[model samples]
Target: MKHQTSQLEFSRPLQVDRVPRLGSVEKLSAEPKELKALAKRMKLPALHALSAELRATPWRGGGLKVEGHLTADIEQVSVISLEAFRETVSLPVSRYFLPAGAVNDNDQEDDADPISNGWVDLGEVVAEILALDLDPYPRKPGEAFEEHVEIEAEPKPESPFAVLARRKGD
Candidate 1:
């Protein structure tokens, strides 16, 4: 269902049937138009570049394992400065794909899923990784965050339960 509702503007599906006995390697690079669409979908200020080198090998019971490394140049708005800044990110990628109805003993591998239409979208994998790796509150170096919130100097009143307990103790 995730693939059906996919808003991923960038996609490069690795065909399951094409993988050989040893393994297969693929290098994916995003085009300019794809980068623009992906940035919009991912809610980023800009995604300048995205590329990955992936290796696909056979796994347990007709499943497939894809491992790769991706590099991206991105622009984000700093949470403190609120100004756009650019950063280069490098990340290691790993994912498992099971054929539909195949059994998986490793329950902890919840991210594993069946291939969509006999293929795995490598671009989606990279995009998801980038999304997770992006800093939620990005700040440029030396841009310190100052807490504008002021704490109450006066002590708070005791709760009713605490007061009652104190009275009982007395």
Candidate 2:
């Protein structure tokens, strides 16, 4: 299918409270320009493709569970070789999003990091996940650091005794 570019920003927000069904599914693919802009925002070398399939379900009384899968092809600069190379990023999105101030600060948990405010933007989440999953120091396949230290040969310093003997002979 011919992919059409979208005007939506990478952080496009979706109001979950406006959904018509309890089990709603949204499939989204980033336009090439959007992906390129997102990559630029993320400081990535390049972005070839980005797409996702997300599902929203009510959970834990008032909270919502946003789950999805993000697949992307990107290019990054290798920290070791200093060359650019392509990579594939695939991340499973699973997180419970609660309205801001719904939970007390003391009750927060690591795994249940909730979304702030009343909206959940799958686009922003996907971008964040992609950024997190990317290698901070990407290196090309089979690229390894090889340290090459050069040693310069120099004449050994003359001993004090040898200097003294030369002075006495003089």
Q: What is the C-alpha lDDT of each candidate?
A: 0.84, 0.77
Q: What TM-scores do the predictions have?
A: 0.80, 0.73
Clashing pairs in 2: none
How far is 25's C-alpha from truth in model 2 (Å)?
A: 1.7
* Clashing pairs for predicted structure model 1, backbone only: none
How much RMSD separates candidate 2 from the native structure?
Answer: 7.0
What would the per-residue lDDT of candidate 1 be over residues 41-160, giving only the tens digit for each residue?
778999999999999897775778989899999998988878999989999999888887663566665568787767788888888888898888888867886778887789888899
Count of steric clashes across candidates, in order? 0, 0
Which segments of model 1 are wrong by more than 4 Å?
1-7, 103-106, 109-111, 155-170
In model 2, how large is the Cα lDDT of residue 141? 84
Name the best candidate (by TM-score): 1
Model 2 scores what on Cα lDDT? 0.77
Pairing residues by index, what is the TM-score of model 1? 0.80
Least well predicted 10-residue stretch by lDDT in candidate 1: 1-10
